[model samples]
Structures are given as structure tokens and as C-alpha cells.
Target: MIEYDSYGRMKYDPQLHFNQGKTWVDEDIDYLIHWLEIIGYEEMSLALGRTEATVRDKVFKLRKKGLMKEGDKSKRHRKLLGRCKDEQAVNY
Candidate 1:
């Protein structure tokens, strides 16, 4: 679903368009990766306007940089698995 303006107009927001395989700057990546340590992937994706895979990739990069811990073997212990990637990202 699209976003409805205050007056109820559905304006086409450019951000809703999921630019897959897009390149990101280090600033956005670093900030998101920092939060990724504290938040789940899906929520972090929403906050950073990226896909869950993008957030995962960021986390993986953090692991490579020694910023985050390695080892996520079980979804059984995963946090916030109930939440999903935002509908806007899915719409793309």
C-alpha cells in the first residue's frame, strides 16, 4: 500500500521504490550496522530504508570488521522473527 498524505492524497514517494543492488555510502552503512547490533534485521532495515538482506549483509560486514559477534546458527533463538520486511519494500 502507498502512503496517504494528510489530505488523503496518495503521493508517490521515491523512497518506496526499492532500488535493489544499490550502492550505499559508508556513513549510512556504519550507522545502520551499529544499530543492527542492538536491533533485529527487519526493524533495522526499515530504519535504514533498505532490505532485510541489506541489513544482514551489513551485519555480516560488521562481523568481518570485528564489530559484531559471529555465529547465528539457530532461528529458534532469533529475536523479532515475527516482524517482516515492510510492505513498501515488498511492493517493489
Candidate 2:
């Protein structure tokens, strides 16, 4: 069964998220970059079977490493495009 926190947010479940806490594979990172450009973290999380937080963290690390640009359109305008509203709310 699914579980939620007191705040009504779904808790992380290893059974549901097989990659949770595991090392990311190269292909996974490639797919992340590809999809991240076309979609928001929320959709990318669902597609990658990862938590949204995990996806966001990965993006941050990528940016810090110079793997992703700070000026990337996805990062600059995802909220303006009406994508990832949930993520935007969390950031605020």
C-alpha cells in the first residue's frame, strides 16, 4: 500500500522506486538530460521512476558540474510555461 506523510505528501517507497538510493547509470543521466529539456522534473520523475526531489537534486548537481547550463530554457522558463507547478510551489 502507498504511504503519505503528515503533510499529505507521498513517502518514498523502495518497492515503487527501484532506483532510490542506488547509483545512477550513464544511460539514466543521458535520459535525464534529454527528457529534462523536453519536460519538467515532475514528469521526468514519473518517467524515470524517481522522486521529484531526487530529480531536482540531480539537476542541481549537473548544473554545478557545468554539465547543464544555468541559462537552459527548461530551467529558466518551466514555470512560465505552466509546467511543474507543484515543483514551483515547493520552491516558493
Candidate 3:
């Protein structure tokens, strides 16, 4: 089941039956990027079943390592082309 905190950030229940392999797949990362493209980092956390802080931390690390591009930092609300919104480094 999808879990949420009092503030609405998504939470995970370790007691819940879990298949680690299925829970943390490459596609999940893609889903996070997709949500990051839609709403923003904070909302992407909820959509991807993680805390906003966790999302931000991961994004920050990825950015620091140059795996995630600045142009892909947030969803584009304007007409800014030539930016890659799909290219991403695999994260495990």
C-alpha cells in the first residue's frame, strides 16, 4: 500500500510486504523523472513514494555529480527548447 505522512509526503512502511527488486527498479527512476517533469521535486516525491527531502537530497547529489542536468531540474513552464528533459543517469 502507498503510505503518506501527516504532511502528505509519501512514506514507506518497512513492515509491509515488500519485494525490493520490484520496488526499486529502473522504471521507478523513470517515473520519478516523469513526475519531476509534471509537478516539481516536492510533488515528485509523493508521486514516487518518497519524502520531499529525500527527493531533494538525491537530486542534489545527482546534480553535484553532473549526472542530472540543470535544465532538467524542474518542469518547464515556458517555451525553452534545446534542453534534454529525458536524458538521465542510472541510479541505484
Candidate 4:
């Protein structure tokens, strides 16, 4: 479940913390990055069942680890889509 502050920003829900670093299937992570790119942070948070900060943090971490490109739109889209497609192919 999600908790929201009075200002409507997603609040850090302790219950959701366990979902972090828990190893999403590649399709899930790809879907996350794709949604973040298309719809932006707030909606991404909803889709990810995470706080907006967590969404931003995860994306940043992915970039830091070189799993995602920082600013190259085409590269980002390809990487993200490729991840999803790979997962689908492998039935993961």
C-alpha cells in the first residue's frame, strides 16, 4: 500500500522499503524505466509502488551503475526496451 502526505507527495512507507533492492525481474525494471521516461516521476512512483524519491534514487543508481544512460534519449529507450524484450523472450 502507499501512503501520501497532505501535499499529495508519496510518503516513505516502511512496508515498501523491502521492495527495494529485492531484484525485480528485468521486465519489471524495464517497464519502470519506460514509464518514468514517458509519464515522469510522480506516475512512475505510483507504478513502482514506491515514493517519488525512491523512483528518482533507483533511476540514479541505475545510471551510476551504467545500466542506464544519463541523457541520451535513444540509448535510454533502447536499453530499457531491450531489457523488457529480453525478459519477455526468456520468460522471466
Best by TM-score: 2
Cα lDDT tens digits for candidate 1, 1-92: 34433432223444632544568778777777566555656556566666565566767787898876765455322433232244322132
- After superposition, the stretches of candidate 2 with alpha carbons farther than 4 Å from their true spots are 1-10, 71-92
Ordered by lDDT, highest first, the candidates read 2, 4, 1, 3
Return the TM-score for candidate 3, rounded to 2 decimals: 0.45
Q: Return whichever of 1 and 2 wins on TM-score.
A: 2
Clashing pairs in 3: none
TM-score of each: 0.48, 0.62, 0.45, 0.53
lDDT of 3 by residue, 1-92 (tens): 44444454434444332322244467756665455656775446545565555766666776788766665533444321122234322121
lDDT of the candidates, in the order given: 0.55, 0.65, 0.50, 0.59
Candidate 4 local lDDT, 34-91, one digit each (tens)? 6666776665665666676777778898888888766545533222112232232211
Residue 39 CA error for candidate 2 (Å)? 1.7
Model 2 residue pairs with clashes: none
Higher-scoring candidate on TM-score, 2 or 3:
2
lDDT at residue 47 of model 2 (Cα atoms) = 69
- CA RMSD of all predictions: 9.4, 7.2, 12.9, 12.7
Candidate with better TM-score, 3 vs 4: 4
